[model samples]
Target: MVRVIMGVKGTGKTKQMIDLINSAVHSEHGNVVCIERGGKLTYDIHSKIRLVESSNYDMGTFEFMKGFISGLYAGNYDITHVFIDSLTKIVNADVTDHTLEEFLDWLNSFSEKNNIKFTVTISADRELASEGVQKYF
Candidate 1:
């Protein structure tokens, strides 16, 4: 399943995502991963969950970010949940409704295929989000 935590910047989205990740770590059986734009939150997240800082790599496009996620799934078959703190920032794009829909469609399919749940934080108002993406919020 794909879920979104939508809100503007400095609205405590990261804290919410961290809380979800920590909860999953204790409640879920499989592995959990958290991907962020930087390493600032590394120490804040539970040590059990894998925290990845994408700023260390060149993930400047949606395709690149998708490939990076695919790589994670390939490397670890046990990953059950993935929490992305800054989806737009990681993709380095001004995601419009069209782009958001396309990305969500692909992500939904990928989540189903891999049997992994994805919870992402998108910096936008609930009404501004695409209908497809808003359903996950």
Candidate 2:
């Protein structure tokens, strides 16, 4: 399953994701992974959930992010839920709209094949976002 929390800045998207991640830690049988663009979430997230800082890897583009995520799954097959704190922040500022759409489409398919659930927080208004980006939300 793929869930998206879409809204503008300061709308509590991160808080919502934190709550979901913290709550899932108690009941999920498999591992829970949280990916953030920076170290901001180090304290709010539960200690049990595996937190990854995207800056540690070459994920400036969504294409690279796909490989990074695939490698994570390859290394740890037990990961069930992957929470991306801010999808927009991980990508390079100059990327094309097509890149975002392609990555999201691939993510949805990848989750289906691996039985992993992905919850992403996108900091953009649903209406103002591109048709490609809006579809994911």
Candidate 3:
């Protein structure tokens, strides 16, 4: 399952994502593998769920996807759910506005074959990027 929680800035998208994740882990007793884009996951929550933090380390789109896909393929069998916070931040560093389509295609394929539940967040202003992403998925 893939879900995108989108809205304008200051709309509490990150908080909403965190709440949803927390609910799944704490209330429902679900195993959650959370991928946090910013430091929000570390500083904002208190839980025993597995958390992976990836911030702006100058990684490009391909490099980011490579690490993400490889990690997921290798470790997915151990977890039941995956939450990817703010998908836009993964590509924000480059902001290439190029290779968006290709990246989206790869993401769609990877998500499907892995059969992992994913939560993706994005900015409301990134229409092209978001549209390309939704189309591919």
Candidate 4:
């Protein structure tokens, strides 16, 4: 239930995420959310989809982002999909950091348990990421 979009900067990773958001919003019966670092995605995601700016809250670490996501799911049970754009940018963590690695491991199980799909975009290529995290992409 967890997917990742990985690439270097300016590789159209966000565009791919936008496509997923727009398409999912049109077909999903439940709510869809796309979380970004700022207001850059306001005009990109579909109007029906909920676009949350991560900078609005106190999020800058893997733990905070994880709890933020958990809180979001708790606040709304109807959410079926969550698209996270530029996770490293929002959380200020290196892609290869162990913190992110553990967080991604948690996300995989969390999404499965909640029956919610998660898609995250990271600004790192496969070679740059650790072997354990490459499978996500």
Candidate 5:
């Protein structure tokens, strides 16, 4: 189950995600993993939450993506939900040789094969206008 919640900055996107995480970790007994990229919001979650700081904006795209993917598969056993604070940051940071579309496609495939539900928050300003928009999460 991959979901994307997009909106303009300060439109409660991150806040919405945090709220969702709070509920899932507090009530659903789900393991919530959040990849924080912007160094903006931080909170104390229950025992079910694991917060990983992927970057503070200084890290490039490939580095952040590699770390995020590595962190997602870091441990063993049931992690119910994974949320990336801003998918745009990851996409923009990816300065790899591959095209942006290719990278996103690879990520989509990776998520599908892993059976890990993910929520990617992207800013409205960064949302690309194209047919491939449907491919995101």
Candidate 6:
């Protein structure tokens, strides 16, 4: 499943995502991974959970991010949950752009195909986000 945590910037979205990741790591039997722009939250997450810094890789577009996620699934079959903080930052686009919808659609399909859950944090309020994308919030 694909879940979105939508809110404006500086609204503690990262904190919420981090808390969710922590909870998932402690409760779930499978592995949990949190992907962010930098390794800023590496210290905050539990040691058992994987912390991936997206900036270290070449993820300049939405498609690249999707491929990177696909690579993660390819490399780790035990991953049950993926927490992506700052979705807009990683995609380097506004939340209202058409690419957001495309990415969400791809993510939905990817999640279902791999039987993995994705929790994403978008830097936009529910009302500010596109109508089609708000349903995941």
> Which of 2 and 4 is ahead in lDDT?
4
lDDT of 6 by residue, 1-137 (tens): 99999888789988888789889987877889888987789888889888888888857799898888888889989999999888888878888898998898889999898889999998877787877797787
Name the weakest run of 10 consecutive residues (lDDT summed) in model 2: 92-101
Residue-by-residue lDDT tens digits, candidate 3, 53-127: 765445446657657656765865655567766665765632235565455456556667766556666655544
Measured with C-alpha atoms, the lDDT of residue 97 in candidate 6 is 92
TM-score for each predicted model, relative to the true structure:
0.93, 0.91, 0.70, 0.96, 0.70, 0.94
TM-score computed on alpha carbons, candidate 2: 0.91
> Which candidate ranks first by TM-score, i.e. highest?
4
RMSD in order of candidates: 1.3, 1.8, 3.5, 1.0, 3.8, 1.2
Worst 10 residues of 6 by lDDT: 123-132
TM-score of 6: 0.94
Between candidates 3 and 6, name the one with more favorable TM-score: 6
TM-score ranking, best first: 4, 6, 1, 2, 5, 3
lDDT of each: 0.85, 0.84, 0.63, 0.88, 0.63, 0.86
Off by over 4 Å in 4: none
Q: Write the per-residue lDDT of candidate 5 for residues 1-137, one digit (tens) a residue.
A: 56667677778887788787778776544467877775554644444577767664444565457555755676734676777777666556432234544545655676677666677787764345244544553
**lDDT score, candidate 2:** 0.84
Q: Is candidate 2 or candidate 6 better by TM-score?
A: 6
Instruction: Give the candidates in order of lDDT, highest first.
Output: 4, 6, 1, 2, 5, 3
Model 3: lowest-lDDT 10 consecutive positions = 93-102
Off by over 4 Å in 5: 26-30, 44-47, 56-59, 62-67, 90-100, 135-137
lDDT of 4 by residue, 1-137 (tens): 88888899889998888888999987888999989987988987789988888888968888888888999999999999999998999889898798888888899999989999999999887688886687787
Clashing pairs in 2: none
Question: Between candidates 1 and 5, which one is better according to TM-score?
Answer: 1
Please tell me which model should have the higher TM-score, number 2 or number 3. 2
Clashing pairs in 1: none
